[model samples]
Target chain A: MDKRREVAVLSELDKKLINLLQHGLPVCERPFAQVAEQVDSTEDEVIAHLVDLKERKVLSRFGPMFDAVYLGGAFTLAALAVPEEDFAKVTEQVNSFEQIAHNYRRTHYYNMWFVIGTESVEEIEQVVQGIEEKTGLEVLNVPKLKEFFVGLYLPV
Target chain B: MSENNNIALTSLEREYIIATQKGLPLVAKPYHAVAEQLNISVEQVLSMTKDLQERGIIRRVAAVPNHYKLGYQYNGMTVWDISDEHAEKFGQMVGNLPFVSHCYLRPRFLPKWNYNLFAMVHGKTPEEMHQLRSQIKELLKDVLVERNDDSSQNIPTQSNDMLTSTEILKKTGLRLKDKTA
Candidate 1:
């Protein structure tokens, strides 16, 4: 909701650049250099524009998304409903834990949602328990009963 | 896809990403803004991100979880118990449904925990959600599931307690970090 932000107008040139980048930067030491040649921008300009778009929050992260299962661990998507008065304190505490990923304040009975990424199912279970003793409120551990393949992609 | 498929990355690159995940910056040249912070060439930042996408490392750059504005204020989890053999197929079919937001297959303890196929349905009202789930249930041809007759369907109970109080606290179990006001 920042007014200083710019709108994403996909020019043909910009679209082509994004299309090539979307396919992925090749696996190499100098990926931007390659993309630059393809996008008709110098490597410096390509990186500069990317940084700009990222600063504007157009891109989520410019890094690999992990496969938790392959990393010898699993996670559960969970939430809770903290009282309004205690929300800020809980947010600070919730945000402190690296394993919790990030917590968001949503509009619902179960609103204070956070993700748990931990080693082993046992660890995952333990993390959930630890969250309970720390906070008096009950936590709704909504573990996925099944898996669905989803990627964060938007056709700009 | 696999851990072995992973390529190494630098710390600065990781920092650049974490700062911008929530939203993009505003400027005629936002890339320059980000580059200035990192003290790197603007082109490097763009290509680093572009490369990450190509390598399948970064998924995409976009805003997320704006569900509130989307009018899906009502959302609930729906779990199922399809036979193991049919679970995978059922998940694919269930995920394809427009009403189904998420679907997953998890290990069950059998007899009691037969509902392995899970999907989430969001609607304006509880009844609307039920209707959508009911429709998806019909698509599970060979899949047998224990659905609620008296109440809404509960996830196959390996644990009868749906609100997992014990496990939830563990993540925040550590000492609270100091906050600078």
Candidate 2:
């Protein structure tokens, strides 16, 4: 986790670009130019700052935020409480599946938490069953009953 | 819309998703770059993307910054067991908080697990994370349940807890398998 941390000191321009672009970029031929106009900067300068941010690992992604569920897919948050000795092996078995989109090691009794993304809603159950069989662990499959909000706007 | 809704993706749409899933090119004409790759007209690419967004497929065309790199080093997946009757009301209130990035009401597995409300919060330090957690607790104080003292009960002893991530085992964003391969 420490190795992945590259704390970049963001400049005023970088912060402005991030805070503005996060809401969304216009879906036009020259969106950057529009953003530049809003920020009182040039299109090339905005592009250069964004490129630098991406390279510095500050920007994880810069594109369309697709909704997997809307795209005829399903996603569920699942957890497994693997034994200490089998942690490494269990992580490998669980992650081998392409369906596992994001996996995290959390501080909890049921430590190994991951999100399963499948092409269809019904396949979510199948993936859960597969992971349980492969790891010999009980999976706590928790799908969202109601989504209150999901807009991620972190002001830098 | 039902979660089971099967909105079939056209072959071109699938190709477009595959082409731009990594990210759009940083150029004067980003859509044109994707159009060139798929051998489709620039107008077609732009129109398809707009259609997808209008259909609620694409949430937004945006830049997602790494929170940790931006000094938000501490992130806690705060879970709570709130009254089902007032869950929706309280969920909305908690979700409206600026610091709360994601808030959802999920099912609980009784006996072992009991948290039905999950809200992810981030902070620059552990102290800040705790403060945010406290703010959430204060917001849902009325709806939050107090665990029964009876040892024989099949419910968890605690009503809420924050599970901070220790490591990112895998961080690959969603990927669609190339069926043609």
Candidate 3:
């Protein structure tokens, strides 16, 4: 079961802060202060809210979102179709690799989907080959040929 | 942007990423905390962060709220078998939709996989997701490949489909291995 289905109740101020902060916070001596000003709250209050949100697992991360490729690394969205009997073992093998950043079970013929983030472009291929050998399954290596849009802004 | 060159993180920048990749300290002066930890001045941290952003390395310094916690429980990876000729044109149209969070063009694995355009859509419920999917379908109606029901070709029978994640097996922030270690 999806454990995150339980929704967290948000106050009006929390929603306002989240909507504003998702776009970004300024880079300065007091970034939270700037956010507080825009959200019509005190710096301490803003920080408190953020701390609460993080503790509650509402905000997964609060920091700079780095581009893997730009940082001399490579990442690709790959998928695999594992036999039901071997699903558990294959998952352990795939997740054991530190390069596998995220793995999910989706409803499809190609059930297991994971993202491989490596230190270099060449390393992406190496990891893919490793996964294929480990699981004995064809890994669909699909790196983005072109990105039309990439942004996550969900208004609470 | 296709050409992967002219972008390399400096040693200090790498250290900065390693230090803060998980997250910044939840403090009034988060940068100050980072600067103190790295044994650098606040000005240096600020400047380095700004430089990274300017170089397109750091997409943004922001808060990433979990959509599930925000009432967006239904999320789908909506993929389409778009014609290569009109993929770019139709991709842009679908991406421009306010509900679409991410849209991209990816290579198709001929016999096994046929989706070329991928768009991620999130909604509070299944009905909402279906509606949003319909909107995208209507926008790409002209370019979407007709359903290939031919079983002989070994291709996907549908023109488009949505993959709803059933379980999150593993999830973690991208970690950059430390070379000095």
Q: Would you list the C-alpha lDDT of every candidate in the order shown?
A: 0.55, 0.86, 0.87
DockQ of each: 0.12, 0.68, 0.69
The 10 consecutive residues of candidate 1 chain B with the worst lDDT sum are B159-168
> Candidate 2's residue-wise lDDT over B22-83, tens digit each?
88988877898899988999989989999999987787899998987888777789999999
Give the Å error, residue B24, model 3: 1.5
Cα TM-score per model? 0.52, 0.91, 0.91
The alpha-carbon RMSD values of the candidates against the true structure, listed in the order shown, are: 9.2, 2.3, 2.2
lDDT of 1 by residue, A67-90 (tens): 334333456776667887887777
Query: Model 2: how large is the Cα RMSD against the reference?
Result: 2.3
> What does DockQ come to for candidate 3?
0.69
Q: How far does residue A29 in candidate 1 sit from its true spot (Å)?
A: 21
How do these models rank on DockQ, best leading? 3, 2, 1
- The lowest-lDDT stretch of 10 consecutive residues in candidate 2 chain B is B148-157
**lDDT per residue (tens digit) for residues A1-156 in model 3:** 466767999988899988998899899999989888898899999999999998988998999998766656678899998888998999999999998989999989888999988777788889999999988898998889888877788887
Interface RMSD, all candidates in order, equals 9.3, 1.9, 2.0
- Please report the candidate that would top DockQ against the real structure: 3
